[model samples]
Target: MIGRGSRRFGLGVLVGVLLGFAFALVGASPAAAHATLASTDPPQNQVLASAPDQITLTFTEAVRPVPARIKVIGPDRSVVNGGSPTSNGTKLVIPLGRDAGKGTYLVTFRVISADSHPIGGSFVFHVGAPSIDPPQEGEAAVTKADPAVVWALGAVRYLGYVGLVLLIGPMLFLARLWPARLSRRVPAKLVATGLGLLAFSTVAEMYLQGPYTAGTGLFGADADAIMNALGGSYGTTHTVRLGVLAAIAVLLRPFVRPQGPSTIDLAVVSFFAVVGLGTWPLSGHAGVSPAPAVSLVADAAHLASMGVWLGGLVVLVAVLLPKANARELGAILPVWSNWAMMSVIVLSLTGVAQAIIEVASFGPLFDTRYGRLVLAKVALLALVLVVAYFSRRLVLAPARKALVGAGGPADDDEELDEPPVKPLRRSILAELAITGVVLAVAAALVQTPPARSAADAPPEPYSVTLSTDLYRVRMELDPARTGGNSMHLYAYNPNGEPQTVVEWTVTATPADGSIDALDIPLLPVTADHAVAEPTFPTAGDWDIKITLRLSDIDQATVTQRVRIGD
Candidate 1:
C-alpha cells in the first residue's frame, strides 16, 4: 500500500511539473534583454536621393560597440565606413565615405549593453533605390544566441544553485547541530561534491559566456570574442567566484573534521562567503539597476537566506532525521526551526525589495513576462511557506515536549504513539520539491529583461496611407507627439508603383483651433520621396494636408487626421 507521505510527495512533484510547464509556455519565445535599437538615421528601408554623410544609431540604453563586428556594406559590396565608429552614451555614429555611391547599404552591428549582455542586428537603406538583391553578410548579423548554448548556460546556473545549497547546508550542520555519534564522512562527501560542482559550473560559465554574448554555438566563440568576454564584468565575477571557491576549499579541510571550525576560521569563511555571494548580483541586473547599492545588498542577502533555508532542510532530511534518535531530535529541531524562521523572514523581505526595484509598478507586474515569472515565483514560495508552517508546528510541539520531559518521565505508552519525525520529514520533502520549481523560475527570471525596462520602451511610429484621385501618399511620423517629429512621405500610383511627384507641400491645423495653421517645409530627397521635421505646439488631433503635383497641370490634395500626444 502507498503511504500518505508518498502520495503527498507525488502531488508536490505533479504541481512542480505543472508550474514548470506554465513558465515554459510563457517564456518559450525569445526576446532581447539587452539594449534595443530605438531609432536610426536614414531609417531602415528608406530610400534617399544621395547617401548621407553618416549613419547614426540610437539605442534605448547606453552600449559599447564591438568595433570588429560593426560594418557598413555599400552598394558596390565594399566597406564604406570612413573611420572607426564613435559611441556617445546611447548613440553610435559611423562616418560614411565621401564618394560613396549606393543602391542599398547594409549596416550590421553588435554591441554590449551596460549590464554585459550583447545585442546585434542589421538594417538596410537605399541611396536612389533598393538593390535587386541587398548585400548580405555571413554571420556578422546573427543576433540570436545558439539554442543549445542558451539551454546549457541555464542548466549550469541551476546546478550552481544546487551546489550552493549543498555546500552551505552541510557546512552549517557540521559546525553546529551534528551529532557526536554519527560519522561525518557522508556530510563531508556532500560538501566536497557541492564544492566540485561550484568549481565546474564556474569554469563552464566562463567558457559559455563568449558564445552566449557572440550569439554563436557552444564551440563557435572566436579568440577575440573570448578575450572580450574575459575582460567584461561577467568574466571578472566568475573568476573571483572561482578564486573564492579555491580559498574556501583550503579553509574547509579542517572545518569539516570532528574538531569543527574555529572562531577565526568561521569569520574568514563568512567574509569570503559574503564576497562570493556579492559577485552574483554585481555581474547581473542588480549591478546596472537604478539603485545599485540597495539592489546589490538585497540580492546577496536573498541568495544567502535561500541557501541557508534550503540547504538546512537538505541536511535535516537526508542525514539527521534518519540517523539521530528521539533525544537528539528534541535538542536539534528547535534550534533548526529558529534558524529556518529567520532565513524565511530575510528571504521574504529581500525578495519583495527586489521585486519592487525590478518591476517598478503594478502594471508591469502583470503585464510583462518578467513580472509573470515573478508572480510564479511568489506563488511557489507561498506554497513552500505553508508547508513549512506545518513542519514547524510538528517540530516545535512534540520536540519541545520531548526536550522538556527528558530523563524525568518514562512514558512508554506515549512513545508507542506516532512520532512527529515522519510527518515532519514528509513536510520538508514537499517543501524541497516545491522549492526546486521556485529555483527554476528564479533562474528564468535572471535571463529575462526586467519589467521596468520593458515598460519604458518607446512605442512604434505612427504610419498612415491616404489616397486621392491621382496618387496614394504614405506618411510616417516618428514619435507622433507634441514635439519635433520626423516625417517621411512617399507617393505611389494606384497600382503601387512609385509615382513621380513634381512638387510637394504640407500644412498642419489643430482641430481645437487653439493655434493658427502651421506651414511645414518638406525636403525632397527623390522624385517620389520627401522628408520633413515638424513640431507640434500642443497635444490634440491635427489635420495634415499633403499636396502632391504629379504633373504641372495634374495635382491632388489629401488630408489625414493625426492624433498627437504630449
Candidate 2:
C-alpha cells in the first residue's frame, strides 16, 4: 500500500541505521589499533639536508611515554646522544653528536601509552642531503593480551560454540538409530535454534568486535579508527567467518532430518561444528602464534568439546524431556553420558593447552581481574563436573529401574526413584548459567594484553648507585609502574656538607625515533637534589641516563626509568 518513493526512503533509513550501528560497535575501542607512530617530522622514507630543530611523530591517538627515548645511529649504529633519552611533551629530543658523519642515520624509539599499551617506532633521515635509504628497522607496534583476559575470552568463546554444536550435531547422529524417537521435525527446529543464535551473536559480535578489536567501547573511537579496522587483517578474517556461517545455514537442511539420517546429515553436522570452532582463529588470539594452523586446531578442539556438552544439555531440557518416554530417555541417557564424558575429557585437555598458550603463569589468576574471572569460571566448571558425575554415577547408571512405565515385562528391574531427576535438571540449569557468565568475561578479556611479555613492558625494578667524593647518589625507578606519573627518584650524600649543582644538562629522545632537544630550565628544590619537570614524548620503557655534576671530580651519572606515559 506504500508509495515506491516512501518504501525506498524507509529502506534507506534501515540501511543507514544498520551501517551506523555497525560503525558504532567497531568504533568503540581506542585501544583496538595498538599504539604506533603514524608519521614523523623526518619521515621513514624521507631524507633531509639539515637536522630538524625538533622532531614530532603523530599517532592514531594520545599515547603515554615510559622514560621517553630516542637514539641517533650516527651512520655507525653507535649511540650519539650523550648518555640516554629525556623528554619534552610529545617531542623526543636527542642532543646532536658534535662529530656526527654525513650519511643516512636510523632512529629507533619506544614508549608506553596512557592506556597502558606499549608503542615503538623508527625512521631514517640523512643529515647532509636527501637520498633514498633501505627501510631501517621499520617502526612497529606490539600487542599482548592481559593473561586474565586471554583465558577469560578463550574459555567463554569455546563454551558458547560447544553449546551450539552439541545442540544440533547429535540430532543427525541419533536420527539414524531411532527414527520415530528422534522425530521427523526436531532436527529442523534444532538447526533453526542454532541458526537464530548464530545470527544474533554474529550481529552482536560485529558490534562488539569493534570495541573488542578497538580495545574500548563505542564512545572511545572515531570514524577513521573504524575505517582502519575494516581495512586490516581483523576485518578480513571476520568477513570469511561470515561467509562460512552463511554457507552453514544454507547447507543446514541435512542437519534437520525429516526421518532418517543421510550422509548429508553427518557431513553437515561436522561442518557446522567445525564452523563453530572457527571463531578462535578469527579472534585476536590466532595471529599471535608463528603457526596459525596449529593454534586454530587447538582452539577448534576446545570449541568442539564444549559444543557437545552444553548444547546437548540445552536440547535435553527444551525438546527431549517432553517428547521421550522413560524407556527412550533411559536409552538416550547412557549414550549421552558417554558423549558428555568424552567431551569433558577433551575439553579439559584443550583448556589446558589454551591456558598455557595464553597465560604464562598462575599469578594472574588471582592478581588480574581477568584472571580472577577465569578462576571463578573454573570453580563453576568444577561444580558442573561434580553434578555431571553424580548424575551419571547415582541416577542415570541404573537406567531400567529409574523408568516408571516400560512397555516390556521386566523381571529383574529394581525399584525406581524420581527425586534424582530433579537434581539432574537443576544441575543442567546451573551449567547453563555458568556458561553465560563465561561468555561475558570473554567479551571483556579480548581487549587486554598479556602481562608477562617484555616487548612493550618495563624491566623489573632494581637499584642503581652513582658515587662521588662528596656523596653517593642512588635513584630507584619502580620498573613496573602502577599508574599515572608515579615515578620516584632518590638522591643522597655521604658527606655532611650539602652538594651544590651549578648546571644540569638534560636531553631526551622518543622510542619512535622522533627528535633532538628543547632548551630546558632546571631549579633546585633541595641543597643536594634539584627538581626538574620532564615532559616525556611517548609511551613504553624510557632509558633515563643522566649525569649530575657537583664539582670537577665530584660528578656522578645515574640512569633509571620504569614504564611511563600512557
Candidate 3:
C-alpha cells in the first residue's frame, strides 16, 4: 500500500502531466519571434542545375546580422561560407567559396530578430545532383539551447516582473495610503528586492544575449561576444535601464522616508522612470511593430498601470489591512480604491490597443500561440476585476453609512467597525493570485512570436532518431504531410564516427493496413548520408525501414514508425 504522501505525490505528477498535455493541445508552442525567412536563394530542397556563387536570404523583417551564426556546409563536410555576411534592409547575402561544388549543401543560419530575440533554421539544397555522401547529422552541430540557460532567462524575467510589482505598488502605497501604525520593514525589504531584481536581470540579460544569439551553449560567451552584445541596440537600451535603476537606488532614502520625495527629486526620478520603462518597449516586439511609436507608448502605459494597480493590491493585502485599525482602514481604503479604479481603466484601454497591434487579426486570436496566451491573460484579468469589484463595494460601505447619518463623522475612529475587514482581505488575496497568473501569461506573450507573423508561416518539419545494434541514424522529413517530402538520413557508428554505407534501402508501410509497403528510392549523397524525395499519399502512421550495408559482410536494418499528417 502506498503512503499518504506517496499518493499525493503521484496525484500531483498526474495532474502536471495532464496540464502539460492540455497546453500542448492548445498550442503552447516554443517561442519564435516575428522575424521569419521570407525566401532564400536556391530555396529549401531546390535542385539547381549548377552551384550558385552566393546565398541570399530575405527575412520578413530586418535582422541584425551575426555572421558566425550562419554556417554553410558543402557536400565534402567542409565549411564553404566565405566570410562575414553583408546585409541590407531585410536581406542577408553570404558569398560562397569556390569549393561549394556539386552535390547537396546544407545551410544553417541564426539571426537576432528586430526585437532582440534569436531565430534559427536549417535547409538543404542540391547542386548538379545530390552527393554520394553528404554531411552526417553529428557533423551538423546545430546545438539546441541549454536547458539551464533557458530556465535562467525565464527566471530572470519572472523575477523582474515580481520586482516591479513589489517596488511600484508599495512605493505608491507609502506615498498615498500608508498608515503610521504599519511597520516600515516589510515594504522596505520589498522595495529593495525589487530594485535588486531589476538591476541583476539587466546585467544577466546582457551576459546571456551573446550566448543566446550565437546559438552556443550556456558557458560559450567570450570577451568578443560580450562586447559585441554590448555594442548592439538591445545592449545599449539595457545599459540605460541599468543606469536608471542605479539612480533609483541612490534616491531610495528619500523615497522610504515618511516625508516622501521632494518636488525636484520626484520630477527627476519620474523622468528617469519614463525613460527606463521606454527602453523595455524599445528592445521588445513593440519597438519593431507596425506603427511602433503608438505601440510603444501604449505598452508603456499598460505596464505603468499594471504596476500601480497590482502593486497597490499587494500593499493593501500584505500590510495596511492586517495591521491597521478601523480608523486607519477608513482613511486609506477610499483613496487607494480611487487610484486603483483609474489604474485599471488605463490598463484596459492600453492593453486593448497593444493587443490590436500585435494580434492584427481576429483569426489568430485562437489560431496562433501569442493570441492564445493573450486570451488566457484576459480571462485571468477578468477574474481579478470581478474580485476587485467586491473589494471596492466593501471599501465603500463605511462611506455609505456615514453619508446616511447612521454613524457620526466619517473621520471619527470610535464609530468605525471591523465587520468587512476579513471579507475584503480574502477578496484582495484572490485577486492577487489571479493577477499572478496574468503576469505569467504576459511574460509568455513577450517571448512568443506575434500572431500576424506566425499565422503566415508554413508547418515546421518532423525529425526522428532511429538506431540498430551497430549504429544510430538521424532522419528529418520536411513537410511530413500527404505530399512530396524531402528526407535526409545520417548514419553514425557506435563510437560516434561517421559510418560509410555501400548500399542503402528504405521502405514505408502504412500501419493501418490501408496501404501496402512501398520501397523508397534513396540516393546516397555520401558514404554516411543519403537523400530522398518521396510523396506520402495519405495521412497515417508509416513504418520506415532503413537498411545500411557498411561492407560486403556487414549490414544492419533499423525500423521506426512516424506519423504523417494531411
Q: Provide C-alpha RMSD values for all models, in order.
A: 8.9, 17.6, 9.8
TM-score of 2: 0.55
Rank by lDDT (best first): 1, 3, 2
**lDDT value, residue 502 of candidate 3:** 87
Better of 1 and 3 by lDDT: 1
Candidate number achieving the greatest TM-score relative to the actual structure? 1
For 418-472, candidate 2 gives per-residue lDDT tens digits of 4345556666677777766655555455545532232223333333555555455
Number of the candidate with higher TM-score, 1 or 2: 1
For 442-511, candidate 1 gives per-residue lDDT tens digits of 8778777788777565655677778887888878787798889999887888866678999999999999
Q: Which ten residues in a row have the lowest lDDT in candidate 3?
A: 400-409
lDDT of 3 by residue, 1-566 (tens): 12345335544644454354344435533333358888889787676878788999899888766666677898888888877888787898888876567777988877777887777777777776555455644466665556666666767777778778887887767665676655677887778888998888888878877776766677887877667655657888998999988988787786677666677877787888798789878978888887689988988888888888888888877776566655566566667766776687677767766776777666677888988998898778777877776676665555433222212223554454446666777888998888888887887677677887777666667766677887777677888889899898877787656778888899999999787888899998878879999899999899998888888988999888889977
Give residue 143's error in model 3 in angstroms. Answer: 2.5
